[model samples]
Target: MTRNALPTLTLLSLLAILPCSGCQSSKAEIDRRAQHIAMLADDTLDELDAAVATGDVGDAALSHIASAKSNQHQIKDEADKARTALHGVEDATPWWGRTLGNLAIAGVLIALVILLWQTGIGFVIKRLCYAIGLLIPRSTKASAALDAEAIARRRACPEQRESIAARRASDPAYDAEFVRQKKRKQRDEVSRHALPKEHMEIATS
Candidate 1:
């Protein structure tokens, strides 16, 4: 009687295990599907992040996780549409035709640059560079020579000689050269007046 009860207990245990085996497999399959979905969602989000890093997405798209997810789907959809449109455009345009168009535009731009250079635009550019301090106006040696020449001219000017004469009135020994300049200026003034009178006398005669 004990052996018979043991077999009955074994049979009951088998029945319980057999029912649980199908349920366990179904639960595993559901978990696997959920994990796959989660992995796919993560991949999509990563793609969105890459797009944002490349400046393809704007600030508004990256503000919140929920909105970002929405943006991700929208971006994906738009990209798909763009790809489809691009493919259609490519199909409509011949490869050689596109290449020729690009080459023509590049040639025109090169010709324009050559024309501008030939028209002395380069000189204008050099002048602009000088004005902006990218180029020097004169060499140091040349500038020094020019400054010396200007100083000599300024000192030799008659107006400056008169100014020196005025200084001599305040300081007797200010510039002895002023006395010679004053005498020369007075002689030139007298000669100028005499010339005008001579001219009038000649005209009357």
Candidate 2:
């Protein structure tokens, strides 16, 4: 049998025996039995003494028999009382009580299953979407144009060019500055290396 089945069976057996077990004598019966045994012992002693004095053992035997019968009667009474108590307890627990208890347990189990299902499936779908996005490439042409414009503006400011270039090389935020400085420097170098414009107009009066 499965491990779970063993405990379940054990529980059922215990429940089945509960009614009968409760029908057995309680503390009161046990105490009554003890008292009766004590009394019987004392009576037997007295009868033994009397039998020896009167030279008649029949009286002593009769006394012993009476004590045994009294004990039996007490035991039967205790058993009956216990049975009545058990019956009352069983009556107090209605069928509806058990049904409601079982329903509550089932409801909790169902709720847990639903929560796990949502969490597991939601996590898997999120991962799948992320992986699909990784497979697709996005356009960067707009981003490139923006970088070029920012570089041109930065190159117009000569005082800020060196600082801008250093920042651009080291930090992602300074990328536009570096592009602007580089473009400006290249244009200046080209202009410096080229010939000046010639004067073709007549001298002014």
Top lDDT hit: 1
lDDT of 1 by residue, 1-205 (tens): 2433544544554554444333334334444555555556668898767777797666676677557688666665654454445433422334655555555555555555555566789657755654344444234324333333433445447775565446546533222333333445567667878999999999999
Candidate 2, 63-182: lDDT as tens digits: 775666566567656655654565444234446545554654555455444544555974455445434333221332233334545554454355455554555466432353334444
Q: By how many angstroms RMSD does model 2 differ from the true structure?
A: 24.2
lDDT (Cα atoms) of all candidates against the true structure: 0.53, 0.51
Q: lDDT (0-100) at residue 135 of candidate 1? A: 45
Candidate 1 regions exceeding 4 Å error are 1-24, 64-66, 69-205
State every prediction's TM-score relative to the real structure: 0.21, 0.22
RMSD (Cα, Å) for all candidates, in order, is: 36.0, 24.2
Model 2 TM-score is 0.22
Candidate 1, TM-score vs. the true structure?
0.21
Error of 1 at 132 (Å): 99
